[model samples]
Target: MVSVKSLHGSAQLLLDVAGGVTRIAERTHRTIVREINPLNRLRDIAGVPSKEREGQTYRFIQSTMSSLQQGLHRSLDGFSADDEPTHSVHSEKVAAALNGVCGDHLEASNNPLAITMHFRNSQGAKLRPDSSSMGATFPNAGPRIVVLVHGLCLSHEYWKGHNEADLGIELQRAHGFTPLYLNYNTGRHISSNGRELSEQLQILVDTWPVNVEELLLIGHSMGGLVIRSACWYGSEPKLPWTQLVKKALYLGSPHHGAALAKAGHLLTFVMHKFRYASPFALAQHTSAGIKDLRYGNLLDDDWEGIDQDEFHLDIRKPVPLLAGTRHYFLAATIGDHPTDFSSTLVGDLLVRLDSAKGHHSDALKKLRIRPEDCRVFEKLNHLALLDNKVVHDQIVEWLV
Candidate 1:
């Protein structure tokens, strides 16, 4: 169920996107017309009155659109209803995808479509960081806690499907560990989410129903980068949760960088080279979070005060794995063997095998994970790492 506020937000976003597209189209059309006729180009360069009139017409249209948008906004607010329905799982998935694409924009615009960070149960009910809420949420609370985090454009629902083969349930049944799922805006900067997560974990630990003797973290894809960022923040401030963390597992995570994200960056760079194609480049524009994936950035310094659209070298600040915590890497490849050319090149069709394994050609950037702690699964793709029985079994083996 989408709320009225969300509906308004969607309408507003659509209007903004339409305006942007129209402006781009107009620019492209003008460029084409000038190319077709040198006289028009000369007139445009000479500050012709016709061009000034055209500019005034465009501004008038823009002002009219702005007035209509404000009117619509005010009309929606006049309903004076607050009993909006909660989101369904399907709607949640859609919201997650939207948040992944332009969440930062949504947030800046105060759009209700932006997802807030929370610890949610299987049914998507947010859990408060208090003893009463924690006890109620986990009737069979235990000392050992494992937090499962999802990747970009995903929710906690990814870890537990409709079947009874959920890893969280299995961990509780087998090892007396309480499983917590974290849902957050994947479109925000990774370091921003990490700082927030670190603070949230502190509250969770302080208010747990039982003593948190052990803490474990499991992350898939971009979630792994968030965990890395969180760990950096925790260790820098000597957070108590950092001391409790026993192990951190990264499944199909691009520790070095994701191949697809790098390719997209390169594509955008190429698009900027052609004046006619530059307008289309707006379609390729991504959020700050996606840009961070190009080099697995884990800090704000990596991108602060820089033009995001401009081509830049990998400026990621290296963060070492948390000390006194066992860090494990689990990567999957479509190839039948880990050493195959496809595995080395394509690597689960999204991340390269070397990137997933935390390998970097530069010594300063390498994670230096022990070879014994890393595992690669052949004949499996990136998403398959979340649901495969073999993968689950291997995780269990590592946990025990």
Candidate 2:
């Protein structure tokens, strides 16, 4: 069943999108009007404006929407405080999907759909590191911990896999490593999420019932970027947990950059060139997190002073693999042969083969992974890296 909160949140999100479209339409109209007539440009400079103005109309619409949103919230608040909040898998999936798109906007506006970081179990119960909580939740928890971070538009539940073959469970059963799932907002900047993850890890380590001997990080897609960012932040401050990281594995991660994001940027730029299509370009103006993926940003400086609306040179500083940790990378391709042009270009459908392997023309930007440490799998897509038995076996071999 859909909760009233979910309905309200979705309604507000739709209203926000509509308002954005209106603003884009208004801007496009102004641009076209100014370009079509020299007098309109002169009037714009003279501050006289045009006869057909949308300022008043736009303001009125915004005010009305705001009032309606507030009224809905007030009405919802009138419900009995004793009513138990219910959880629905469908609602959670919808919320996660929305967060993956415009999550940064939702977070900035304090929307209810914004996700917070939490260590969750298969049942979606939050796991605290305290003795009582850990004892109850994970009675057989081991000293070595393996954290599984999901990609963009995904949840911790994804690591469970479509079949019964989950890497986390396999590691626990075969290797004595306890598995933990991290669920966070993927729409935030990698640096922002990284810093938060670093802090959270510190707390988790400090509060663990048993001494944490080894920490292994397994990240897929954007999750890999977040892990890298976290490691950078954690090391800079000399965080204690950083020392415990034994290995970090990236699965189909876009270390250099993702081609799809760059293509989206180019499309947005092209759309902006035409007045009528400018409004449609509003769809491309995604969250800060999505924009950062244009070049697998691992630090705040990678995105600092960069304009998300226009194309800019890659100003990101190099962030290498964390020291004292064995780094491994896995690249996947949809083609049957690794040498195929489609394999190199399409690369698991989202990431390219070169980017996933950290291969770059610039030596400084290139990740330092040994030839033996990286593997390329054929005929597998990005998500397949999470469930493939061969990949899981390889991970176990490395860990053991």
lDDT of each: 0.84, 0.84
Model 2, CA-based lDDT: 0.84
Model 1 TM-score relative to the real fold? 0.92
- CA deviation > 4 Å runs, candidate 2: 35-38, 47-55, 77-86, 129-131
Cα RMSD to the true fold for all candidates: 2.7, 2.2
lDDT of 1 at 216: 90
Tens-digit lDDT track for model 1 on 1-400?
A: 5578778878888877777777777778777877999988898788887546355556776777788679768878765445767777788888889888887887887777788888976556789878888888878677898888899888888887544467776777778778888999898989999988999999999988888999999999999999989999989989999999989999989888899888888888898899899888853557778877888888889879977677888878888999999999999999999899998899999999999999888898998878889999999898888888888888888888
Candidate 1, residue 116: Cα displacement in angstroms equals: 0.6
lDDT of 2 at 319: 90
What is the alpha-carbon lDDT for the whole of candidate 1?
A: 0.84
Off by over 4 Å in 1: 33-54, 77-82, 162-164
